[model samples]
Target: MKLRFPTATIAAVTFFASLAAGMTSPVLAEETASPTIVTNLRATPMVPANAPVRFAPPAEVVQTLSVVPAELTAADDSVTDSTTDFSTLDAAVAAQSAAIDDEELNCLAVSIYFESKGEPLAGQLAVADVILNRTTSGRFPSSVCSVVKQPGQFSFVKGGRLPDIDTSRRAWKTAVAVARVATKDLWQSPAKNALYFHARHVSPNWGKARVASVGNHIFYR
Candidate 1:
């Protein structure tokens, strides 16, 4: 049997079926109606997996970033003091506050006193520079005491021992100041980089390069 409904009834039935589907699933209807939400989600920017992450540092950390370290500033001040100009080497020696308590400094001052105390201030500083240079020359003992007491070196060292020094003499005081200047590198040495020096009276016959002849001694590099 063939059953045929009217055109208006078929239209009414189709409209009700669509309304029922809308009531059953309201989320699907909302998504279909508002497509801009989906567009926004798809349009969002994404970082690559290998991209570097960046963050704003705290205010205190940013403030400290440009500040210089205290130790480094002190080091710079020391360098400036070393290069300060004086009218003469005598002025430089006079400026030193020489306290001869340290054993190494005592050894250096004693050597200067015995070797060239009678010589001019420049001569005394030259002797100190020679001893200081020998400490770093890698060819000699690495300390002032060791270098001074090295066998067959300074004539004043008697069997690896230094002789008693008269500490009350003006010459001894001057030697102590000269040692301070040399150790601190406050003044440039006339006998720069000198490793060995001998009295001007004797020739050791050493085939070494001569650097300078300051007062009573001849300095060799």
Candidate 2:
């Protein structure tokens, strides 16, 4: 134990010992090895299959909508106005006839006579007569009010507005009675199938076109 080693030999042994300790240490082993890399596959983005998509509308796309024709609407109006609940035009006229009186009938006859010996009493009645004549000729309304209020038929219609009648007037009462009689077909012999008429003084354009003449008036076919 007392023997001493050479100086060079001691130095070489010390260097080899330090190198072996460094190789066995955990810190040195970690610093000498290659670095590890990690990746997370779930962090990547993806599009859903049910996602909504945008697009421009077609230039010539076809569309559908509901509509009502004018003729169909008019037919509906006709059906509503002409309900078959009333038995006949005559029955309706008779029902309304009771509302008139003898005084009204005389006043109506006087007013009608002022126009002509056998003329209709009121303007409405005159129009009704014209319509009746047209009906018999197969060219006008068959009903009383329908004939009197025919579209564009009478000048007194005033833009197709029917005036509220003054039923309280003596002349109007007479006119109403006359209307009732005419509606009842009491004077059918006077203007049978006559569709045209004019005042006694003025010749009618329809005179030459006449089928007959009654009292001071001429009638047409």
Candidate 3:
């Protein structure tokens, strides 16, 4: 069978076909448009002017150190230092003779008693003078007890103590009298500036200035 269509119907059909093709062609062309490539590195995002920014607190900083007290440091320095003013032992002790008293006087008396009881009164006075000098001298201990008790320094000291002295003995009383007079400066020792002494029996060869000879002992500075 032959199919026939009117001209106006054919024209209408042609117009509808053209409209459909035009709409679909644009969509297909857009799908095949040039593509843009994205990179691994991205630019930093810009924050809006009014945006609230969040920030973590900076890491806490810590410091540790030990400090010493100034007073404690000073005390430590004083203990380790032994040096003092350089003054003549004779002049120093002579100026303060009364400092030797109380139990300290007894110590001086005992030292003189045991050391020079056999010698004359002058010898005992000289011994006491030597002890006082040593006390003032910075080279020896400052206290009378300390000077008398110093090891290997005095022949009378024994067992780190003075021997049992007989205070009742006349000799001891004489020694006490001598020590009192010497310390009180009532009588200046013949060995005025002497800080050392020894029995005449043996020479220490101290090679020092000889001050005086009293009884059996010779005194020197």
Cα displacement (Å) at residue 36, model 2? 99
Candidate 2's residue-wise lDDT over 66-139, tens digit each? 35567766757335434434354434334344354453343333334343433433333443465555555556
Model 3 Cα lDDT, one tens digit per residue, 44-82? 466799999898554452222345568767756334323
TM-score against truth, every candidate: 0.63, 0.39, 0.53
RMSD of each: 12.9, 17.6, 18.3
Ranking by TM-score: 1, 3, 2
Q: Tens digits of per-residue lDDT for model 1 on 1-221?
A: 88999999999999999999989798887878798987898899888999999999999999999799887777585576677887888998898766787889999999999999999999999999999999999999899999999998889899889899778888889999999889888888999999989998898899999999999999999
Error of 3 at 126 (Å): 0.9
Index of the highest-lDDT prediction: 1
101: Cα error in model 1, Å: 2.3
Q: Which pairs, if any, clash in model 3?
A: none
Q: Quick one: how many clashes does candidate 3 have? A: 0
Error of 2 at 26 (Å): 99
